[model samples]
Target: DQQVKQNSPSLSVQEGRISILNCDYTNSMFDYFLWYKKYPAEGPTFLISISSIKDKNEDGRFTVFLNKSAKHLSLHIVPSQPGDSAVYFCAASARSGSYQLTFGKGTKLSVIP
Candidate 1:
């Protein structure tokens, strides 16, 4: 019954390469998609997010793409660095305007140098 799902539990990428994280959702009512990065013993920090109305959003080396029709989303990090290694969580929220969000299990990303 998990609404948001990250099929891959972990992903490994070479330094200076591109790291692509994928996420899927079963609930069509989701109006927003958010990606969070968590470091060891630290709270998850907001990385990037995309609204359902847009297909893609980019910030520096991070890019997020959303395919509302397919209920799929992805996060791309170019020139992956060791510091970028962390657990990334995909979350979604309905149009209810409430802060409650459905989160995925999260994908652990390891950027090897």
Candidate 2:
């Protein structure tokens, strides 16, 4: 069973357009959510995060919205640029333990010039 899922393997958008990525989870115990952006052959960098207690979190061009009832979350990038063409991974962790995060396969967003 995939505890976390990103249904779309890739997405393409024009520069200065909005890019939206979707994610879903099956575990109800997850209390912390995170979004990570990665370049080729590099580790993911933390983009934004939201706790289960909150529904929305935003940072700069990135925003994450969580729907606890549906066990779903999404990431939105405003005015996407060519630099934004990278893999985005959605991760979640429970409150217990060392806060180890589980990740989705990732969605590769390609921004056209």
The candidate maximizing TM-score is 1
Which predicted model would earn the best lDDT?
1
lDDT of 1 at 63: 99
lDDT of 2 at 27: 91
- Per-residue lDDT for 46 in model 1? 98
Model 1 segments beyond 4 Å from truth? 97-99
lDDT by residue (tens digit), candidate 2, 38-83: 9998888989999999999989999999999999999999989999
Deviating ranges (above 4 Å) for candidate 2:
none
Report the error of model 2 at residue 85, Å: 0.3
Q: TM-scores, in order shown? A: 0.97, 0.96
The per-residue C-alpha lDDT of model 1 at residue 98 equals 78
**Candidate 2, position 48, lDDT:** 94
> Candidate 2: what lDDT?
0.95
lDDT of 1: 0.96
